[model samples]
Target: MRKILNTAHIYMIIGVVSGLYSRELTKAEDFTGDTQLDVVHTHVLALGMLFFLIVLVLEKQFTLTSSALFGWFFWIYNIGLAVTVGMMTLHGTLTVLGHSSGEAIAMVAGLGHILLTAGLILLFVTLGKRLQPAPAPGSDAAPDPDPAAPLPAPAP
Candidate 1:
């Protein structure tokens, strides 16, 4: 939970900074009126802030920490998001500076998406397992359901 909140905070800060950066670009001589800055703001806000915020809420309800894959999901998802945004930022900044972006940037972006996809797949699997019904009150065939939504005992 702390990690989730911290991640959310990080994204929020980045979003705000990007917004400021966008404004700064407007006054610069190199401003070509491209949407890069706008993209930067949206990227940070949509993925960085909003994405984490939603995850934080889901964490409360689903308690992601219980899953073995929680750590993997958290790290992979965040790393992917960071990489994707980083590449986007790099390309966007270059474009804003009137520099030509090339194939290398696109390659990195593809890698970032791969990481992001892997993270999301892990998340989906974890959520599916978590939402399954718990063992019938200690039948021992299964473990437990989310404490917040405990399954009832076997039909009496």
Candidate 2:
């Protein structure tokens, strides 16, 4: 949960910095038309910062990191975001300078999007599994739903 919170914090910083950078870059280049830089700010904020903040809350409520998928989701999602945003920054900078890029750049960005999708699917699956009710004691019908989860503390 701490890691999740820290991730959100880092992303928030990055997002805000990117937005400021975009504004400064555009002003410096005197480019008025829309570019990917404008969108990258929102993408990093919503998908990276906001998303992780939500995840941090979910982790607090559900102990999401207990699941293996959580780790995978973290790494894959970060990698995807880095790729997508990196490409956006690169492509947007080039556009500001009146340069065009080949199709390969766009294709790589598409691949990053695909990874994002996969990471989202993994998160949903992890949450679904975590939300399943633990089987009743001494009932063999379903066995234990999540063996790795610690037993709840006894009530006072």
Report the number of the highest-lDDT candidate: 2
| Maximum-TM-score candidate | 2
The clash number for model 2 is: 0
Task: Note the Cα lDDT for every prediction shown.
Answer: 0.81, 0.89
lDDT of 1 by residue, 1-156 (tens): 888888889888998898888778765845757755668778878877788788888788877779999789889988888888888888877777778889998898899889989998998888887775756865758564447686779997
Off by over 4 Å in 1: 134-156
Cα-based TM-score, every candidate: 0.80, 0.84
Q: List model 2 lDDT by residue over 4-108, tens digit each.
A: 888888888999999999999999999999899999989999999999999987887788999999989898888889899999988998898899977989999
lDDT of 1 at 8: 83
TM-score of 1: 0.80
Please identify model 2 stretches exceeding 4 Å from their true place: 134-156
